[model samples]
Target: MGRQRTVNDHGFWHSPLLQQCTTEDKTALLYLLTSPVSNVIGAYPLVPRIAAAEVGWSKDQWLQVIERLRAEDLVWFDPERMFVWVRIWWFHNLASQTMGPKLRTRTLENIRRLPEPWLAPFLADYKARLNEEQRELLNTLLAGEFSENDASVPHGYRIDASSNFSLYNNNANAKPNSNVTPTLEAQAQVPVDKSGIPPESHAQVEAAIANAQRKGIVKADTQAIIAAVAKQYQAGRPPRDAGAYTYSIAQNLASVATEPSPPAPPSESELTAWADLCFCWPTDNPSSFIRVDKAGFCEQVTIENGNARHGYMPLGPSKLLVALREGRLRKISAADFEDLAKGSRP
Candidate 1:
């Protein structure tokens, strides 16, 4: 029996490559994807007549669509064996990939239904086009016969049901908050270091520090180092010696923190004062950015000595500060500051 299929609405509609296809082409493609015969692998038994009937297209129209898809390398067709292989099929259907040895068993069942050689081209195409991880999964799915040396066949490698990380991080390949089950081959890729120790708990960290103090590590700064080391060990970078190694790590943090802090943002009142001193805001035109002296005065400055005058557009205190910082407004000249001081009387 063919495996179940799932089509994501967002992924199907907004796919970059599908955006290139016409509306009619998208509809036809969707039908091919969701049809009964199209299994989890996105390849299935399909002849021209069968496709034409299922898609409600004339044989000629169907051939034209197929030709377009083939040109884009979207779908590959095998005329001799009547097979259809959708390119990059694994990427789309990753949500259904929890199958393990059962997958290999299913392939053996399929071999009897569709002669084994019919699968050769699909498997070869998958290997050449896919990455190592994806290629490994494709091979696993097609491995129908039992192998004494199969890595998954080993009883020890079976997914540990009680492991929280494996359960919560099931879809390691997909985005966060997704339930997509990644292939077993993908899970095998995670770097495992048997020698790496688990992080210390908060109580354990405190206990280690108390122990360090008994060993004459009672300096206040030394205690700070122990705290930082405890944090690192707790965060999965466990050290071989949790009790004594924290001081060196803490000293490193002190050196790292010596970099200068970033400048603070100006207060809202400062922005308001700067605007009141600089611009005659909320202008008559409601559009002109009216430049003003410190005492609420406006200016008509000509551009390039032309009769055409430069006008100030209205900007709130926040936006006016942005203009000043961004250099859209120039700094006041010394002579202009003298004039502004004279006009300061209101």
Candidate 2:
């Protein structure tokens, strides 16, 4: 597919808001605006790891940039749902135009798919930007338009001076308004104590949750997975790497949810032979499979003269047995299996 194009307002550089952003923040914002995952409506799903990879930065670097942008009110990121809303996207792209029926339908679908907390805020912004024709179209398409008086607007919702919508009550001392609606950004900013998570570990858990979603764990299963992690923390038995532990649990849950019946236990005979395993190169872009022939190895491959050779440094037979049971190895018939033991380029 060809690269997608997004509008870049010539006035962007002159904006006062742009002056406040660091070079890194500006780069991150521009990337989000033009990212392939981004759509016409500007709100879209974006995995933190993927975004990091796109910019040739570490995950931490990407998270830091995103957090800064969020603080500056340039974007809203929902770590749990992996969604992003570029705050002023409409101004540069759709504000001056009247959308056709097809575009309007697609836009509505995109809006509906936004994370629950982002829906109202995005709609509010979208409604405010509509041209007369667009507004008329929206009136027909939506049962109730975005409005302060609209029932869909939460009870305490209000638009502040900056035009940001918040759901805090007037009673400042009344237990901090537990009834306030949770937006994705608000949820991300929830206090560590209330969330049962350590202040420093939010990013890790978010990354883990994104990983889980990629591994086929559905949104419905997230609450249960989070509960399991929270229970461990409460019991004072938290894992050394909370993110890794959460990912492992997610993997287990995903496996159970997908596989109706477990495979037969590995036999002793099956455990001894070399298992030929084929995996794709550059995982995300798989043009060819890089086959590993010596499938009995239990440790990292040894490199000699720029070639990979296995079995020189074995962890143990016990680990090998575990790998076999985990379905990580499968025996395959190849005429030159031994010749390819050292993972030669295909």
| Residues 270-330, model 2: lDDT tens digits | 5344344433223352322223334333333333565766553332345344544555544
> lDDT score of model 2?
0.55
Q: How does candidate 1 fare on TM-score?
A: 0.35
Worst 10 residues of 1 by lDDT: 158-167
RMSD for each model, in Å, please?
A: 21.0, 22.0
Q: After superposition, how far is residue 50 of candidate 2 from its true place, in Å?
A: 0.2
Question: For candidate 1, lDDT tens digit of each residue in 132-216?
Answer: 5655775565556533243233222211111111111222343332333332222335432222233222222332333333333
Residue 298 in model 2: lDDT: 33
TM-score of candidate 2 to 2 decimals: 0.43
Best by lDDT: 2
